[model samples]
Target chain A: MLLSIKNLHASINGKEILKGIDLEVNYGEVHAIMGPNGTGKSTLAAVIAGRDLFEVTEGEVKYKDKDLLKVPVEERAREGIFLGFQYPVEIPGVSITNFLRTALNELRKYRGLDPMSAVEFLKLMEEKKKLVEIQSNLTNRSVNEGFSGGEKKKNEIFQMAMLDPVLAILDETDSGLDIDALRIVAKGVNHLRRKDNAFLIITHYQRLLEYIIPDYVHVLFEGKIVKSGGKELAIELEEKGYDWLKNT
Target chain B: MKEIKTDTKEIISKERMIGLFEKNREGLFMTDSEFMSRIRKDAMERFRELGFPTTKLEEWKNTDLKASLEKGYGYYLHPVIDVDVQKVFHCNIPHLDTAIIAQLNGWYVSKDVPLMELGNGMILGSLAEAFKEYPRIIEKYYGKYADFTSSGLTALNTAFAQDGIFIYVPDNVSSQKTIQMVNVIHHPESIFLQSRNLIILGKNSRISLVHCDDSYNQQASFANIVTEVFIGENASLDHYKLQNMNNDSTLISSVYFNLEQAANLESHFISFNGGLLRNNTRILFNGKGGTANVRGLYLMDRKQHIDNHVFVDHANPECTSSELFKGILDENASGVFNGHVLVRRNAQKTNAYQGNKNILLTDTARVNSKPFLEIYADDVKCSHGSATGQLDSEAMFYLRQRGISEENARMLLMYAFANEVISKISIEPLRLRIEDMVKKRLRGELSVCEHCVLHCNTPERPLEFDIDVTKI
Candidate 1:
């Protein structure tokens, strides 16, 4: 198992968000959590990424059979847990290339490896830049400073391609992306997918599911996984809106 | 009515200054020119009337120099130190070739002659020597720009300062080598010194000047320095001021800039460390179509205090001025930025802008920033803004989530913040050196160097970082 969550309960400022959520994922699989607005899909990703804003009141999370809840945010990142932020922050003055190189070298150091040379780092950056079809000049600019909405999503995927996390949880990565950007992002994810890694993608609409097929789809509503099924279930839910699930 | 309490220290300091002038009138300040002597006397009268600035004044409200002034500081009226000039100051800037001039305490020190006449028709030497050699030029511009009547410190410096760096660039000549002036203070006890510099750029001339202030010891000291720069019509001047002092020192540096028609000026102030530093920078556009870009970056921590007061006078039409000053204050460090721009009634088509931004690391860290603009011309553009805040928390989380350590993440953010001003540096070598210094400062590793910054960082020991900052 890549990640295991047992009866997870979380809240923000004494307001419960993820109430009694249980989920499990294994390697070489893709799982999509489809939900309506205000559902707990993003909160689950935050808890897994070790964001401190959401307090975990009960239960536990296990990544690769280790107690992941005790790890720090950066430590979790080094342990191959990547969280694509819903709204990427604009860090002025920090070039995208610099940010990525620093992040990659840090992960290497955590694993008792030497830092990457400038030449090799540049080569790797060049190779990864093609995955998202980002222009070479875009990497020289500040990280998401003046990037369009589509560019931000592509940058996120570009980062994912560079880090190559064991388990990637994307929080609304397709939210603000246009159709072209959605296809590029999905293609980038598909290119990075391997037999050893898994993805837990959170989305509100089924429009993105057509590009990147998921093996399993979970219907999340009111802070709980109310229904879980195969890929066909996503099409069923998309046909009969989430309101049907609420009525049931 | 608000009652003003009399301060005994201010009175004593004022009286001490007056007594020093009376004692050194004939001996230390003996001048051959009667006009120079009269300028000194007039300055003394202004000092007696103005005295040292007090907190009661609006400009000095945020900065209190009473603590710095209370220290018993010894005054040196002459050149008392005789040390090896080359051994004392070593400028090791890689690939940066500059004409170096040194000053010990307040008097200019040189191993060669008192003045150097370059083949390019430029003169570099001591101000005292210039008073005798180029009396005509000195009499024309010596006291023309710096307004001693408004500032008591400037008045005191004008009366007491004996020897400082002086440069003269003649008409239509472009200086190939940058002129570097290094003012070093090395004393065992608390000391007080005054220094004055005068630079003249003739018509159609261009020159780059780098002025550095460094302290070799930790003893308490107070420095009152004044510099008058005159840029002739169609001339250009690129000026840099790098100040790095120990925490026990106090520096009050007032610089006056006079620009004629079509003259251009770019000035950068990179202050790394200081105890109590206040920079009084005033620029006057005396002719039409002049442009001035003044930028400053200061990084201070501990109990240090820094204040920057900039005044721009658009006296002629089609003049433009921009001021951008940024600082990062940590611990209990405090700062003040006062930018005042005045566009006269007839100064049409004038564009003036001023901005001050600060990031306070701790809640106790504070900054008082006031950007004011007074425009009398109806056909002018003027704007002013100031912002003070902490590092963005969202950006912090974003960087940390990418596997960067908390410490490196903070450094990256702060570097990005300080780089905005550092990027304005036109000199490549100086900009690179300042980038390294700023990085070391942000990491809390910048120690008081043995010499100035240009000589401090040798090529052998480059800064080590786990992450590559060169790309940033």
Candidate 2:
């Protein structure tokens, strides 16, 4: 198992969000978590990413059989956990290339490995740029500064492609993206899918599933996975909505 | 109100000055021309009257110089120890192509043994030599802008100052490489020294100068500096002052700019470390169609204090001026920014703007920012704004969520805030060097060179924070 969560209850400022979330994921699988508005979809992603904003009151998380709850955020990232932010931050004066290079070197140092050479890093960046179809100017510009909404989302997926995390969480990556941009983002995610990697995409709509197929679909309503099924479940929920799942 | 006390120490200082004047009276060169003698005399009398500014005065209310003034610092006419330029300061900025002029203990110490003259008809040498050679030009703009009566520090510098930097750019000539006037104070004892600089830009000419003040030891010292810049019509000048000294040093520097018709001036003040740093900057629009931009950035920690006072006189119509100053105070450091923009009655269509922003990192860190606009002209457009706040917690959390360590995240955001001021640097290499220095500073990695006295990284006790890894 790549990730295992048992009765995970999280809250924010004395208000509970994820009452009890128990989920398990295996390698080489794509899980689409479909939910309604304010159904703890983003909170689940933040919990998995070890975001300090949410307090985990009970239960535990295990990543690759280690106690993931005790890991720091940056250490989690170095351990191959990536979170694609819903609203990417604009870090002025830090170019995208510099940020990525620094992150990569830090991770490499943590793993007791030699850092990537400048030429090799540039080549990898070139390949990832083409894979994500981002403008060349973005590599030179500040990270997400003055970027359009679509460009910001595209930059997130581009970073995912560069980092190549083992467990990647896409928290509303489909939001605020046009159809063309959606296709580009899905295609970038699909190109990076491998047997050793898994994805848990948290999104509200089923429009994104048309491009990238998921093996399993989970209906997350009121902080719990009320229903779990195959890919067609997303289509079924897209038509019937979460009301049917909650009532059932 | 407490009266301005003429202490016994000040009297001794004045008597020492009179004694020094009598000692150098033969070589005083008073007979060279009456123009130079009158300036020295007027400045001497003023210094006799107003010894030093007092806290009772409204201008010196925030910063009390009593701690620095009562030290009874010894006066030094020259370096008490052997002054070897190479051994004292071995700072050669990597890849920086500057014709460096060195000054030790307020005396010009050059490498060429005389003066440096480029093919572009520019002169860079000792001010004492310039006074003997170009006395006419020196007399025309020497004591033109600085008011000797109000600022006793300026009067002291004008009266007792002997040697400093002097650069003269001929008409229609531009300096190829930026001239770096580096003043290094490495005295054996706690000393007091005054230095003066005179810069002249001819019509349609240009010059970029990087003026630096550095100290070697941890002993206390006082540096009183006065620089006068005369910009001819259509000429442009880029001036940058880099000040980094030991925490036991006190520096009082006054810079005056006189802008002619269609002339432009850009001045940047970057103060990295100091004990008590005070800068009085003044810009006068002597003719129409001129513009001046003055900006400053100061990073201070510990018990450091910085005071910057700027005044831009829009005495001519159709002139534009702006001032932007930003400072980051950590620990118990305090700062004050007083900016005044004056537009006279006949100065119509004068556009002026002033801004001062500060970030106090700790609870005891404080800043006093006041932006004043005194406009007598009816048709002038002028505005001023001042803001002081802490770093944005949201911005910090946002960066940390990207998997960057907390320390690195804070450093990145701080660098971003500081880059807003450094981004205006037109010179790429210089900007890059400054950016690198700032990064090292933010990371607490930069340290003083064993041989160089320009900058040192004092090892501070590790800062402790009660940060909850489980909660931001």
Candidate 3:
């Protein structure tokens, strides 16, 4: 397994957010986690990204046979784990180019390599920007400042393409995006998909799964996954609301 | 009588100033006309009555100068001359194009070459020379703008001030080059010095001045300086002040701006490093359709303390004034920002705004901000706001999620906060230089920045933030 979480438990502010979450993933696979609101879907991704907000009281997150919870947030990124934030922050004075360069250099430094040249970085940014079809010039602008909802989500996908993480967890990346933006984001993700990498897409509805084409889907309800199935389950859930699963 | 309070703590500087004045009475009054002497005498007597402000006063409530005043300083009757001025006080701003004037130990250092004489009757020289050559002009605008009765420091500076920078622009003339005043305090011991500057912009004239206060030595010293600027009808003045001094220094600077009809002024104060700095900025819109924008940014750490007190008086209709001040405090450092805007009864259609924002990096760091708007006119739009808080946690989390370390993320946010005011600088080169300086300050790189002309030290703790403010 490329990543594994066994009997995971996490809480914030004395309130348990995730309880007894068990999941496994391998390379060359796209796993979709579909859940209703307040089901701890975002919390799971945040914990995996090493956010200090939650305390993992009873859990073990194993990545590449190492204790992933012991690593810091930035180190997790260096170790090939990326979390696409649902709401990107607006940094007023930090340009997009500067933020990305600093992040990229730190990851390179962790891998014991020289920092990328400015030319290389800009070229890489341009290439990745093509995947998301971002028309406006974002390099000179402050990060996420005054960006439309669609543009912010697209920028996230663009960043994922640039970082090329082995295990990418995009937490609710499809929310607040229009149909065209949704297609553009999914296209960007599909372009970056490879046999050596994996993606965990967290979404609320089946609209995005049509484009991303997840091989497996899991239903997370009230901080626990109640059911697991293949792509056919999504269509069934689309027809029958989540209340139908409560009877079983 | 206002029942002035006098104690031993504040009387030391006053006594020293009066003693120095008595000793140098002849030399001080050497080139003075009767009107000038009478102005000086009135200021001297006012200083005797007003004395130094105490904590009881509303303006000095947050900042207490008891410790600074108790320090024993050697008073100076004259600035130490005979040293090589050019070699010691060389202008080091890289690629900055400006008309430079150097002041050594509170006295304007006369350049060997002739002073700048722009055609159209614009003259830039020493105030001492102006007293002899242009007495009528000096007597007209010298003490006209500065309020010496309320501030003892201003009164003291006016009384003992013998030589400083003198700038005059005739009507319908505009200076092509920005004038830079480099005031270098290079005394050997703990000395108390007072200096005054006079700047006059005639009708339809324009000029920009970059005034910098730099100290060359680490010895303890005190500086009480006053500057009066008069902007005639339809004139414009862009003033920039940069204060960089050692850890054991005290600087009290007061600037009075008098603007006439349709006059425009943009003033920026950037205090990068200092021990104890108090800036008293007063602006008066003397006529209609005038606009004044005053902005300040201070980056203080360790034991440094900076206070910015701004007062804008809209005495005429259709006048606009705004004040924006930002500060980043680390370690045990503290700062204060007090902005007051007053719109008189006849000053209808006045637009006034005042804001102060601060970021406290450490638990021990402190900041006090007060914004006040007093309007006697019902047809005016006046607003005031102040904010003091820790860094935004959501922003921090977002940055860290992208793999930026906790340290660098905080630095970026601080620079961003201060940049809001810095971005308003219209001059490109000055804006860039200030941007670089602000970055160096945020990174605590001033101690290690070899290319930086300003020299300073950094503490060991390096202003680390409490990054675990995640509420959820």
Candidate 4:
């Protein structure tokens, strides 16, 4: 198993967000957590990514059988845990090339590998840029500064491709993207999928699941997983709506 | 009369300053013209009446200089020490070819002579020597733009200042090499020094000037320096002021600029480290169609304090002026940015803008920013804004999530913040050098060195960023 959570409990500022959550994932699996707004979907992703804002009152999160909560945010990232932000930050004066090179070099250092040369880094950036279908000269610009909704998402996936994390958790990556951008983003994700890697895609809608099929779907309502099923459960929920899950 | 307070004692008092001026009237303040002596005498009397500013004054409210003023300092009556120019100061800026002008303590020094006359009809030398060599030019422009009556420090500098840098550019001529004026204070004991500089740009002339103030050792010192610049019709001047002093030093520098018809000016002030620094910058649009852009950036940490007071007077019509100053204060450091723009009644079509931004790294780090515009012209456009806050938390998390350490993330944001002002540097080599210094400064690795700001600590080495972001 790549990731395992046993009765994970977390809260922010004394307001309990995730009351009790249990989940398990192995390599070569895609897990989609579908829920309504304000249902602790993002909070769960943030806690697993080592955000210090939330306090895990009880339970435990283990990555590769080690305590995941004890690791720092950057250490989690170096351990191949990536979280694509919902709203990508606009960092002025930090070019995309420079931001990625620093990130890649740090990750390489963690794994006891030599830092990539400028020529090699630029070459990898070019390859990743094509996978996301980013046509503009966005790599030379500041990170997400003045980028459109579609461009920011594409840049996130571009970063995902560069890092190649083992367990990728994307928070609402398909919310603001258009159809063409949605297809490009889904294409990038599908191309980067491997047997040894896993993904935890959190979304408010199931429209994105149609493009990149998830092996298992969990309906989270009121901070607990109410229903768990295969891909067919997504279509049933798409037709029946989430109101049924509230009563069940 | 304003009541002045002081605790740190055993230093020169106002009465002693008056006695020193009277005693050295014949020897130190010597000049051929009687008018010059009268100017010096009047300035001394003004200093006696105004005295040093205390916390009671509105302008000195945030910065209290009582401790700095109380330090016991050796005030010299003349340049009694000789320093070998080549041995004391070394220029190590790689590939930056500039004509160097050195000033030791408060007096100018040279290898051959005190003055140098270039082939393009430009003159560079000591201000005291210029009093006898170019008497008419000195009489026409010296002490004309500086406001000695209002600022007591300016009055004191004007009264005791004897030797500094002097530059003159003839009409229709421009300098081929950028002139770098460096003032190095290397005294064994604590000292109080005052230096005065006068620069004149004739009609249709252009010049680029880099003025640096550096302290060699960690000795406590107080420097009261004043500079007056005059730009003739259709002339342009590029000015840069770089200051890096010891933690126990106090520097109070005031520069007054007068621009004539269709003149242009761009001045940048970059201060790295100091105990207490106050930069009084004043710009006057004396003629029509003159434009001035004054910008500043200061990086301070520990218990350091920096204050910048800028006043722009749009006295003529069809003039434009803009002020943008940014600072990053860390630990218990404090900073102040007060920008005032005045547009007169007849100054129609005048446009003025002022903006000040700061980022305080800690809860104890503080900044007071005030942007004021007093406009009497109904047809003019003026705006002012000031903002002070911490770094964006979202950006911090985003960088951390990308596998960057928190330390490197903070450095990237700070370097980005300070780069807004440094990117405007027109000279490529100077801009690159400043970029390296600013990076080193953000990492707390830079200190008061024995050479110029352009002098890299390790020469002949390619600049590299720690986070592998150098190409950008």
What C-alpha lDDT, on a 0 to 100 scale, does residue A166 get in candidate 2? 93
Scored by lDDT, the top model is 1
Q: Which residue pairs in candidate 1 collide?
A: none
A55-127 in candidate 4: lDDT tens per residue? Answer: 9999999999999999989989999999988989999989898899999999999999999999999889889
Q: Give one digit per residue, the lDDT tens place, for model 4 in B1-472.
A: 2211122234857876777777777665675377678778888889988999888998998889888988877776456434455544555677676888878677787657788898998999898889888888898999999989998889988888788999999999988688899887766677788999999999999999999988867888899999999999999999999998889989999999999999999999999988999999999999999999999999999999999999999999999999999999999999999898999999999999999999999999999998999999999988988989999888988899989999998988888889889999998788988888888889887767724455565633322212111110
User: What would the per-residue lDDT of candidate 1 be over residues B1-472, giving only the tens digit for each residue?
Assistant: 2221122223228888888788767666675479788999999999999999999988889889888888777776656444455655556787777888888777787666778899988999899999999999999999899999988889988887678989999999998777888987766566788999999999999998889897866877899999999999999999999998999989998999999999999999888999999999999999999999999999999999999999999999999999999999999999999999999999999999999999999999999999999989999989888999999888888888889988889999999999999888877887888898889889888766634456646632322222221111
lDDT of 3 by residue, B329-356 (tens): 9999999999989899999999999999
lDDT of 2 by residue, A1-248 (tens): 99999999999998999989889999999999989989899999988888888999998899999999888888888888998888888887778887888778777887898989999999999999998899888899998899999999999999999888999999999999999999999999899999999999988899999888999999898988899999999899888877887777
C-alpha root-mean-square deviation, candidate 2: 7.5
lDDT of candidate 2 over B1-472, digit per residue (tens): 1111122233225566656655654564344457767777788788888878888987888888878876766665543223344434444555556677778767787444546677877888888878778888887878887789788778878776667888889999987787778876665467677889988999999988888887756767788899999999999999888887778888998999999999999999988878899999999999999999989999888899999999899999999999999999999999999999999999999999999999888999999999999999999899999999988665565555556677777787778778888899887667876776677666755442221223233333221222221110
Which order, best to worst by DockQ?
1, 4, 3, 2
lDDT of 3 at B240: 91
Give the top-scoring candidate (DockQ). Answer: 1
lDDT (Cα atoms) of all candidates against the true structure: 0.88, 0.82, 0.82, 0.87
Q: Model 1: residues >4 Å from true position, as ranges?
A: B1-12, B459-472
Give native contacts recovered, as a fraction, per prediction: 0.81, 0.30, 0.72, 0.69
By DockQ thresholds, what CAPRI class is model 2? acceptable
RMSD, every candidate, angstroms: 6.2, 7.5, 7.1, 5.8
DockQ for each numbered candidate = 0.83, 0.33, 0.69, 0.74
What order do candidates take by lDDT, descending? 1, 4, 3, 2
Candidates 2 and 4 compared: the better one by lDDT is 4
